[model samples]
Target: MRTAKDRLRHTILFELLGLVTVTPLAALILNKDMGRIGALAVAISLLAMATNYVFNLAFDHALVRMGRPVNVRPPWMRALHAVLFEATLMLITLPIVAWWLNMSLWQALATDVGFALFYLAYAYVYNWAYDRVFPMPSAVRIKAADR
Candidate 1:
């Protein structure tokens, strides 16, 4: 499990990197001014920061409760994690995206889906790398046999 400080650091880094990479690209792709796109991206990033911290913490806890190994994420687990995270964020951000961009709901859905796809991959790779760089705490649990 990550300490609060560690989770904060991860959230900040994730949003910062995501903003830097995605904001400009979204602007160009959507034919919107950078300011509008940047504002929207930053706003969503803020929401995502909160989401990321809570979601990751809850996710790890869920894994542990299910008797799964933390930090040693199998590929399938990583995929599921990424998909679920993106889905959660998509639901939270859809209305915001529609309102911010003055877009129709369907348009917002399309645009948000694009963002979700990018983030789904980004979350997977970023987490894999982050875990390698700042590995999760080793478990305190011992097998019943060992006990």
Candidate 2:
């Protein structure tokens, strides 16, 4: 339901803020160099940015078809969706992250989980703030409700 420009803004802001937060935290937590953490974070952020665009588009389309509005997802549904999405993304990113950082696969998995937890919370808060700060236009909201 978001315009392309809005979605682009979301992607950029999400990644930028995430990089700012995650790099330092990852370095501190994992006892890695800042350069390593920053590189890994950037790689993951790029992958996530692409995935975010596709996943959101699909999710919105499904919601519309299911007569579900965008504002509130059921708690259980959100939990399941978030966990599944993170898990799938971790699988895709873990190897690259580990290889880049010269870590074992298990280490990578654990590290990825740590980041995922952070992002899960970040995404929830970010989206809540995003909606409040840049709410859907009144016309679109009315049209969506009428449907």
The best candidate by TM-score is 1
* Candidate models: Cα lDDT each: 0.89, 0.81
Model 2, 1-147: lDDT tens digits are: 689999989889989998999899989998989997898888888998898888887877777678677666555666665676677788889889889988899988888888899888787777768877988654435375546
**RMSD of each candidate relative to the true structure:** 3.2, 3.3
> Who wins the lDDT comparison?
1
The deviation in Å at residue 115 for candidate 2 is: 1.2
- lDDT of model 1, residue 56: 89
lDDT by residue (1-147, candidate 1, tens digit) is 678999998899889999999999899999999999999999999999999888988998787778777767898999998998899999999999999999999999999999899998888889888888988777746457733
Model 2 scores a C-alpha lDDT of 0.81
Query: Where does model 1 exceed 4 Å of error?
Result: 141-147
Runs of candidate 2 with Cα error greater than 4 angstroms are: 72-81, 138-147
